[model samples]
Target: MNRFLRTLCVLVMLAVVAPALAATDVEAVKQRVAKVDVLRGEFTQEKQVAGFKNPLRSQGRFVLAQDHGVIWTTLKPFPSEVVVTRDRILSRQSDGSSRVELDGRQQPAMRSVNAIMFALMSGDAQALSAQFTVKVEVLPGNGWKMQLTPRSAMLGKVFAQLTLSGDRYVREVQINEANQDVTRIQFAGMSDTPTTLSTDEGRRFE
Candidate 1:
């Protein structure tokens, strides 16, 4: 074949193959996520504002176990923590004040965290779909972004949408709420960390 013709054929082949390769990668990521037992990482939450001259922000790390549940422990701008366990939710402030929500029915914020964690751990699209419109997209470097938009009038009252970024392992999450408030969290080195809920860690939250 002529050089120009050969080059043209190669380009056409790549154009068709690229998308299929991406889809395969996305499916593989989903499969790996479904079987994940634990995930741990450092995180930072950046809250943004447009109208206000100042913006609010926070930082944290998280440990998530599929069966045991989630922990969001902020380490910056003051130390604080939030835990969502199988039975209850716990929040401890920097000033030593603590709040507990049992059976997932105490605070709206707790409920929101629980809902998002459930969707992430269970890989249940329907759970999120009940509240948010879900769009799964292929991200750069074989990663995935699951964007969620609130469907319920009640839910939209608190937040507008949420975006979860990850690969075969979850790497970051952003919860974009109403009032121009945005919480962006980036997870680092999750796969290497152990996320088992030991007796000592469990007691600390309790």
Candidate 2:
């Protein structure tokens, strides 16, 4: 389930609201998402496997630094953290010990996944456009919706479709896997204040 949790898009703290969209397009949604330098927030995730009747659930918090990378710490059911950067991915336990590490330079798939993770967390429409066939819709209540289909061979292996729905800030991300599994991630008690990383966060980036 932890490996499947990698597909979750966590930490969407959009405190700065934008004007209602005059146009319903990826560009418009991109403009609405808060462009903060640092964002910290809590998240809840649900993983529904095809054969299982009950979904597996977990909640966690994440720190996203646009200039650096993202640190995701899962707190329930298990305690571990996955840190994502441009060049590599580092997964560790709550004890600050390494569990898994991958270099983008060594694995082609890792490079693609890293790019997509940053793109999704930061609401980078341009980056997403480059990789997925994107469709956008204007919800009746003023929220926006998006459907993304993988355009790459590597992505097609893990994901079938990705749905994003939110207003001002993305509120939920639903992942549809190729193997009939689904994962939904929602943020709670989210805020975009304190636009600076803490000392421990800074050290983790090293």
Candidate 3:
């Protein structure tokens, strides 16, 4: 299909799906999730690549400080850390040296990368609505599941869909890429106590 036709198709699909989305209280789910200002948890991610027989797996612990940023420490396969903040994404080696992977000072659009990660981890549905047509399903025991489909031709070329579900906090996220690859992440051992960051963890943000 031509580019024009593809664009038209997406517009038509949104026109049909918009009403049902409006009727759902997805904002409430966002509010519930946003209550946590600080949280720490362990995460396991599996990435299934196209044509690859085995999926790549990694285990990590994460600290989400709404005031600062997120710290993802990968402990297995390779020891490293990725810090996603409002200004840049910092990558650190196991030995403690780190570098800025994407700096918004050099490229303003790099901020979008920051926004996307914060919105996803912080459950800011309104932020995601800018790029995706989202559908929210309320689950038993106050849980909720959301599926996001790309809204633009550019994003549609990269992501087929993204599904996320959680109760008091986000529990899992599954991403479907346009190339038939899939990535799934699950969270466990979440806690909000001991709100203060450790000295070492605090230095990572510097």
Candidate 4:
């Protein structure tokens, strides 16, 4: 697959797993993520594909708005942006040219992907449980980890497993694909302050 398609697949994998956690632990995570109406963070992603001597790496900043959806901007390796909402997926190049845009009304898969992204990021247990069989582990210091196995045979053909770890927000996401490729993403410098998105920043979603 090309770089952009590969990256897109990785994004979809962000919510690929839904494991079982204690009810209290699950509620705690849901509550923690619920406090944020908007979230901004920096991320580093590494993909280890079989037969590649070195892993592909990229760095980016992301914005998640409760109603506006997600704006992910990649700054390293190459500049690109992906804006995903309930109704559409917009991809743009560094030159401010549109690369691809998918409307959910025309493409039902886009809607499904968008929903999965939101559910995964927001820690919505009900939505996740609909897709994957999940197992969650409580860690020391109020942190938690989760492992997800695909409940659908179709999903199992594409992914082997997915794991997520975090405290108040998702700190890491790991995807093990059926092809033996693995992608790991680490998020840092997260902020959920009301001022996190300025007027200019907010316009990116438009």
Candidate 1 root-mean-square deviation in Å? 15.0
Which candidate model has the greater TM-score, 1 or 2? 2
lDDT of 2 at 113: 73
Candidate 2 local lDDT, 103-198, one digit each (tens): 778867667677776665555656666678878877766578777788987777777887877776567778788778887888666666788888
Off by over 4 Å in 3: 1-34, 97-100, 119-126
TM-score of each: 0.69, 0.82, 0.77, 0.82
- Sort the candidates on lDDT, descending order: 4, 2, 3, 1
Report, for all candidates in order, the number of backbone clashes: 0, 0, 0, 6
Best by lDDT: 4
Minimal lDDT window, size 10, model 2: 13-22
Please estimate how well model 3 matches the true structure, expressed as its whole-model Cα lDDT.
0.64
Relative to the unseen true structure, what is the C-alpha lDDT of residue 178 in candidate 2, on a scale of 0 to 100?
Answer: 75
Runs of candidate 1 with Cα error greater than 4 angstroms are: 1-29, 32-34, 94-116, 192-195
Clashing pairs in 2: none
Cα lDDT listed for each candidate: 0.53, 0.66, 0.64, 0.69
Candidate 3 lDDT, 107-179, residue by residue in tens:
5444654555455545554666777787878877878888888786766775698777787767877777777
Give the alpha carbon lDDT tens digit for every residue of 1-206 in model 4: 33444456456445222212322235655544435667778889998988998999989888777667777888999998887777877788966776787677886554665576566656575676777887777787878787878776645655689888887767888888877889999988987787456897778777
